[model samples]
Target: MLKKVRGTRKKATLGHIRQETVYLAIQALQKDESLSIQLLCEIAGIARSSYYKWLNRKPSACELENEQLTQVMLSIYEKVERTFGYRQLTLHMRKQTGKKINHKRVYRLMKLRGIQSVIRRKRAKYVRSTPQQVAENVLNRKFEATAPNEKWVTNVTEFKYGHGQKAYLSAILDLHDKSIVSYVLGHSNNNPLVFQTLKQALQAAPGSKPMLHSDRGFQYTSLDFKKLLDKNELFQSMSRVGRCIDNGPMESFWGTLKCEKYYLHKYETFQDLKKDVENYIHFYNNERLQAKLNGLSPMEFRNKAA
Candidate 1:
């Protein structure tokens, strides 16, 4: 009956936890009684040889190097507010330390250290709004470009501040190097917000006739917006109705922005939100490295190509 009760009392436990518990028990027993290691091992259900091996083991050179690398990774992870996954962490590590660290090693170390990127928010579906005028999908999801300002993608995203007070961010992203060309944040998702974003981009890069692509939103399809694009000698490309993937790179930038910054914190004031948005865009453009860019930031890649 006692054995039955003992069997019924068993609970599942982790291997390391069980090992630590056995070591503790052995230590306590050794303090009061001179028990042989083998006896203690037998009682603890561990091999006496294994106990001695663990007691005498020293960290290998590889282990020590891993420990140092883990510390470096933790520093980078915290510095970036834990926004990087293993691949980005690996890139940053190699660049910062000038070490050829493998991404798989970084993945293992991150797993062991319980380090991970910030949780990403699920993408929201876009509502198909009626358009005043629509252009053909000339860009046709050709996201890659050979030179700066050769292709641009633009979109407007909504954010909420105090008590559901909404703000809209309209921005254009250059396809060549994944850099944000220009951005405007306002309280209304109106035509001017998007128009200003385009004007800023055009003013920044005058005489650059890029194919400007956008979703079939009211702002993008308006007659005034079309006239502005025509006046600048820019080709206007609109995503087909109900096909959000046609403007995929622009959509991806929004996902990256919200995942890395906006979703991580709450903003009680509009000013604070706006400031954070500006800071994040600057970081995205100047500091944050992309793997596809060979561990260079967006601006770095652009300047290198130039």
Candidate 2:
């Protein structure tokens, strides 16, 4: 009769059995000094042998180390609002501790603790412009540049907000450091948008005669656009027709902007969207680290070069 009762109790607790549940059972055992070990184990759905093993076991060295690291990670995650991935977290840890830390270990710790970065998905870019009146693809998929302002890529992207009113963002990216040299936001994606962006880039670095690259957009092919580049004595290059990949670095920038910043929040007004974009661009330029830039921000990379 006793054995049958024990079996029934064990069966009842089996559905709720877990490591945490076992820990609670241990606490319950301590509170009730008169409870039989066998009866307690039966109620916990654990064998008497398992209970004894757990009761006497000590945490391993690895477990202790992980616990310590977990606390450190929790603090770091909170500091960054939990948006950093393992790669950035690894860098942040080293920067915080002033010691070299292995990224793999950080990855392992994040996995074990169920901590992960905010994931934002990338969107595909739409095709723009006709092929006629275009320059040759002189940039030719050569995205890397050894020095600042040696090569520049420009593109226009649209942001729709507030009853589908569109705002155009025209910007130039330096291939050397992946920094935004200049940008303009306006209601229209016109020649003036691209022209003003170019003028600003030249103003910022007047000495650097960069080879400016862009897709064969109407603005790029416009007489005024070509005249402005000629007046500045800067080289003009365009991507191949129907091939956005030829100008991949600029395309990549657009993808990154949409994924990491734009897509994460909602925009109720044009001003609201513009403000967030401005903030995000500043954050991206100064705070966000790029893997290829030796885990440094764009401004940091340029500062080092300068």
- Report residue 50 deviation for candidate 2 (angstroms): 7.9
Candidate 1 — worst ten consecutive residues by lDDT sum?
Answer: 8-17
Per-prediction TM-score, please? 0.83, 0.75
TM-score, predicted candidate 2 vs. hidden true structure: 0.75
lDDT: which candidate is best? 1
lDDT of 1 by residue, 187-233 (tens): 99999999999999989998899999998888999999999988989
Tell me how many clashing residue pairs each candidate has: 0, 0
RMSD of 2: 9.9
- Provide the RMSD of all predictions against the true structure, rounded to 1 decimal: 8.9, 9.9
Q: What does candidate 2's lDDT look like per residue over 1-306, in tens digits? A: 999999897665453234535655565776777678787777767778877776678978966775776677788787656767888777667766666778877876776556798776555457665544668788899999999999999999988887778889999999998998888889898888888899999999988888999988889988888888888888989887778898898888887787666766678788888897787788778877787898788999999999
lDDT of each: 0.88, 0.80
